[model samples]
Target: MVRVLAFLFLVTAALALDPLPPERIQALAAYSNAHGGHALLIRQNGKTLHESYSNGHTQNEPHRIYSGTKAFWCLTAFAAEKDGLFKLDDHVADTITEWQSDQRRSKITIRQLLDFTSGLEPLFGLHQNDFKDRAAAALKAPLVGTTGKSFIYGPASLQVYHELLKRKLREKEQTPIRYLERKVLGPLDLGPQRYLPDPKGTPLLAAGFMQTALQWSELGSWLLKHEEIVSAFKPGNVNRAFGFGIWNNHAAESKSAREVDVEDTLDKKWHAQSWGNACLCRSAPADLIACLGSYGQRLYIVPSQKLVIVRLAKDSKPNDAQMLRLLFANTR
Candidate 1:
């Protein structure tokens, strides 16, 4: 584990990579702007290289990041593990006692939930802002496949994980929102997000975060400076493309790697989606990780280059591979 250091010194010492040159930023921003993108911000080694906003978007204005919100919740899972709440592989049924009676559900682990491979039905309805008691609803979701052998990407797995976390925190006399506020958001200096709490006051864990481009980059910066981030990118058994609430370009190194517009693939029914050998962009470095949301919200983190780039937009026209190729093509 890398000794926790303020990013200033950490960037200077651990990552000797230089910031993106001026023309690179211009090219990246141009590509983004031409494709309905409203904001493009780039940071490297704890310093802002360039920040741009257009089309009525401002630096401070917040926009919905959608499932990009999952990465933040996943941070809570790691924090809980650090606090000895439970191991990532621990059976979730241990905390959600009612699950113990369900064979497949009882076998699900904490890591499975974060990775979206717990076999729980995707339950897309959980994304609705008014959906009530998401945790309870997720608990009732049945297995769509063998536990640990399926990648059912949706809000259900995360809601169940949240329920388990809530139970674990109760033993410590804490609440989930406070734990997230203190353990995750506070460190990033981000304020309370639009969690969209249900009638039961249980905040939706799968999505509903709204962050400005600059604000979203804060998480990317933290990830670049965190020494243990490599582990967080570990691909799951069911989905080689997703890991711990983040998507990776590890498959970019493969000859069979398919350049995928993730939002399109996710639009298909979970059973219809084929995630095998999916790579965001073959031209990008294999270490690249992304938090992608609907309608082209993006946070691209390249640990190898000590870089973090945020691209926020209104609609889903921006091309991921082309956008990344534009930036990396201008790299020194």
Candidate 2:
């Protein structure tokens, strides 16, 4: 792909793209103050930057990345793949004994789990149950759609996959948390973190992950460089096809969110891909910039523009369209 020098040059060049002026910084500050607080425009190399803000918190503070945990789990999957613990085609039922008796589940593979096509029926209305019970009930649940056919964007399939993987690894005397600590977090020098395990004492692989924006940025930057993370997945021949579990964020037009409200125009333009589990991530403006500097949320290596863009907000009301348009136009 793109050479490392080319990527670095692009990042350096992009930082010069209209550095947030005093007025804009003030506006962002005001915005952050109004909504708890925020950080802004913290730049690293083209591969990393930091934009963080909080109402009462400041930089280096911990926040619930919500479903951003999905991306983190994706990283774990990469680690697993790189270690050759399991192949993408490995059968989920084979990995988890409970599912083997169920013929439908026997057909499910790790690839299907990553693509949200496992067809596992969802276990709803168990917010009261601890993580373990919730996961157990989900495993016993029935299948709805045929495996690898319907794209049911829900939690049931992933939850089951997490439990299965956790069990499989645990049998080998491994756990997701340990795997992440030794393989991912530790490798990146990111530690002093926590991940809640299910009642059965397994890392909630599909969810229950927490980290600061800085930690998130570290993972994001790694992806932007096409470093070890993406190397785990053999890239698919299809441009936007899901390879392993990670979505390739190569272009703005390849996402599904672009058509969120504009159904009539869905075919006219592709939408932004959804980073499931975690929705749009939350961080200060600066942390987000670092992520964008390396194409954090987009998960692509765009050395030509040397630009990464990230927006973190509880709601999309403040309007990112105008700001992103301006940013892209100036950079181009």
Candidate 3:
């Protein structure tokens, strides 16, 4: 009886230790504040361990997640697939028709678009404040590289995906945003999500999504429970560290792994294409997955530990490696 009780106690203690101690949480909170953090939330095994807001930010105030918005569209795509809208392997040319004659464009698949391997020109205008008919513009953009050849991180590829999805759902009168709400956000019970639209009224699929820290945490939770969406985390062949709108740290375990210096890589000219090869945190679990945005916004999920952490900020400054080290300290 004593031995059995000890084993049970060990399991319970392991489960309880996940979100780190209060002192460490306080340290992370301090780190966040020093680096322009607006909000932070950490959950383990479905329980909130820490939640804090600063700089006049409230718990429920909406904040732009920037590139983190990409993950939501990725999820919506999986949902659309489940609903029989189309398969990931389908050629984008099948719906767009405009690309049918262009051999390279005709070979672009829906998966490539979601994974940033579409070879579409990474347009700056799509992200600028002067939004126009982004879908139409994306359709008009020429392929800058061979299809499935390289990973180009930009709004243009996602915008092209928006155009494809729009054409696919045109007969149903369901806009991409509406379809996302119905299939992905609705089931998660997330939103009043703010999706900014272009002048021609197509939702900016790549960026301009706003949700509170709690709301985003809920998304992380939902992702943990959804296998179809989780499957999208598999690393793409073009960028071994990046999947469909998310970064997979597990790529470090692959035989083809290469170093990824985030600062140096991000500094390359937007058009100078390259692929990422390293894990976000070499010390963290290989199963770690992250939804990162331009301005330090982050949603980290570690399935191995049943952990979900959210950090929102005004700019990119926080170090994910350092944060993970603090969170996963050895309690022994």
lDDT of 3 at 231: 68
Evaluate all candidate structures by whole-model CA lDDT and list the values in order: 0.85, 0.49, 0.79
How much lDDT does candidate 3 score?
0.79
Question: Can you write out model 3's per-residue Cα lDDT over 193-214, one digit (the tens) per residue?
Answer: 6667767777777788888888
* Prediction 1 global C-alpha lDDT: 0.85
Worst 10 residues of 1 by lDDT: 1-10
Candidates 1 and 3 compared: the better one by TM-score is 1
- Model 1, position 42, has a per-residue lDDT of 84
Off by over 4 Å in 1: 1-21, 330-332
Q: Which candidate is the best by lDDT?
A: 1
Better of 2 and 3 by TM-score: 3
Clashing pairs in 1: none
Candidate 2 segments whose C-alpha is farther than 4 A from its true place:
1-37, 41-54, 124-132, 231-258, 261-312, 316-323, 330-332
TM-score of 2: 0.67
Q: Which candidate's TM-score is highest? A: 1
Per-residue C-alpha lDDT of model 1 across residues 191-221, encoded as one tens digit per residue:
8889898888888887889889888998998
Q: Pairing residues by index, what is the TM-score of model 3?
A: 0.89
